[model samples]
Target: MAKSEQTKAKIIDVFLGLTNKKKWDKISVKELCATMGITRGTFYQYYNDIYDLMEQIEDTLITDLNHRYQLLPLKSPNGLFPPELFDSKYDYSPPQELFVWFDFCKNHQKAVSSLLDTKNGDAYFVKKLKVILAQHINHIMDYDGMPRDGLREHFTKIFIELHFMAARTWLDSKEEDFLSIREIINLLNTMRVGAGFLSNKQMTSPDFEAKMKFPADREVL
Candidate 1:
């Protein structure tokens, strides 16, 4: 609760508030400073730019997840995923000492939604996320047999992108009917199980793709 830390947090609050209202690219330094009631010099003292501020916010969340919440070292082989990472259904406050990504999202839903709107995380943030996910899904990806590097990478990529899509859909539409968290969980479970099955099966990629079709051989382009 030091003055400097408090000031920085207030700036962050204003920054996140702005993100909810506009694209991250559109929010300028002057505007954010005006919202914070601080001079540009003050902002510079703590952050280099808006991106820096956002990254710091992310860093703080990661720190809490790792140390305070103990969500770090995420369980693997189908461990620490949606619904499980989130608090109980329709709730935000995690059970005592139980923290997950949803806890942070609940607090900054608007801003996080904005950043995700950019889809930039697919390259940057998701790279960081994949590290955690890989540790957890690696076992499942090769459950039936040993997978080559390419196989693991390909499955991991799909897992991260699909999860992001599901998460984005849920965050954008908070309504229970918009997209059930259970459905998202099911999607993830499918990927986990699919990875295992594909590992054991001798079918080639083409063979697997051939079996997956849309009704008739009608292509909609």
Candidate 2:
């Protein structure tokens, strides 16, 4: 990485570190610079203020996720999609490259928590998330019988919002409320089922069953 990018990343690291420890409204630019071992001037060279720094962090994350989403294969390879899944198959589990989105949140729990804060406006992060997610909606949703335009796009947007908030809830929850990844994936499948869009064959497929396995299912086996 270039010197400038490294400096900015360090500053963002400090910002996210502090953000996790305290309320977003309580975090300050001076603290970020102090932790980064840089002057306020150096900080300003890269960002206008704390919010600018926050937006930059969000944008960097979103752009990387968008890039990852782009790399995902449009359809499962000849052997990747099981013959058992057939036409109703949609890789609802996040695409392999986009799995980085999960890693980003896991590594930046505090940062993700900080973005969920509504003190300023969280719509910015949510909107950015929508863009990252919306593009891959087709990969996850069954499109064999549906048009790509109109209602399809609308529900994809809604499902993106639902997925985002569900993820946020999972992040924000304590052990009691925590939603495991499998549970969440099952919830997503359930959502499709409820939408009257999921098919019986798809629901019963080995591909779906493989991805939807729970701990209990393993125990039973």
Candidate 3:
């Protein structure tokens, strides 16, 4: 890497370290520079201020996440098998694409955990993640022929939040307490598969009625 890029990376690394120990508001540019033995002028060359650095980091993460998501070799609805084909006794595994995602999170654990910290993290970053997850969920539902009504929309919201909770739990856990990435992936896949089965049953029920009206302006994120 070039000298400038290396310097910026060093700055980001130190910043992430500080974020783990101190609240976002407690972090300052002076302290960051001091920690790296760099002058304030060098810091200004890369970022306008502390908040600017945070925003840039958040943007980089989101962009990379979206790119990775888009590259996933997701199958179409026609390629999906019926949920009935698998039972509780069946050995279940998540798609490799999901494993890739979990791996990314694991690799960036510190940055992700700090940015997702409820007390000190940016809500905007969380909101951006929700938007990305919602899009992915909607794509799956669309391909699976799931109805896009209010009920399913609500389900999507709950599903996304459940994932966030699971991720946060895994990310924040100690090394000794940490669950394997595959285990977390499998757990999430189980929930998704179970939900698929329930939704299929619900739609096929004799008394089923699609009465819920999704508001035109309702935002799932």
Root-mean-square deviation of each candidate, in angstroms?
A: 8.4, 9.4, 6.7
The residue pairs found clashing in candidate 3 are none
Q: What is candidate 2's lDDT per residue for 47-114, written digit by digit as tens?
A: 99987877777877677667666666676433324434544554344344335555556666766766
Worst 10 residues of 3 by lDDT: 83-92
Give per-residue CA lDDT, model 1, range 155-213, as digits (tens). Answer: 76776677567667778884866755555565566566555445433343557665665
The TM-scores, one per candidate, come to: 0.62, 0.61, 0.79
lDDT (Cα atoms) of all candidates against the true structure: 0.59, 0.64, 0.76
Ranking by TM-score: 3, 1, 2
Residue range 1-221, candidate 3, lDDT tens digits: 99999999999999988877788758999999999999999999999999899989988888888888878877665333454643432333455546656776787788888888887777888899888888877766655555567777788788778777777899988867977777787887887677666666664555544434456687464
The model with the greatest lDDT is 3
Query: Residue 75's C-alpha lDDT in candidate 2?
Result: 62
Deviation from truth (RMSD, Å), model 2: 9.4
Q: What TM-score does candidate 2 get on C-alpha atoms?
A: 0.61
User: What would you estimate as the lDDT of candidate 2?
Assistant: 0.64
Ten-residue stretch with the least lDDT total in model 1: 89-98
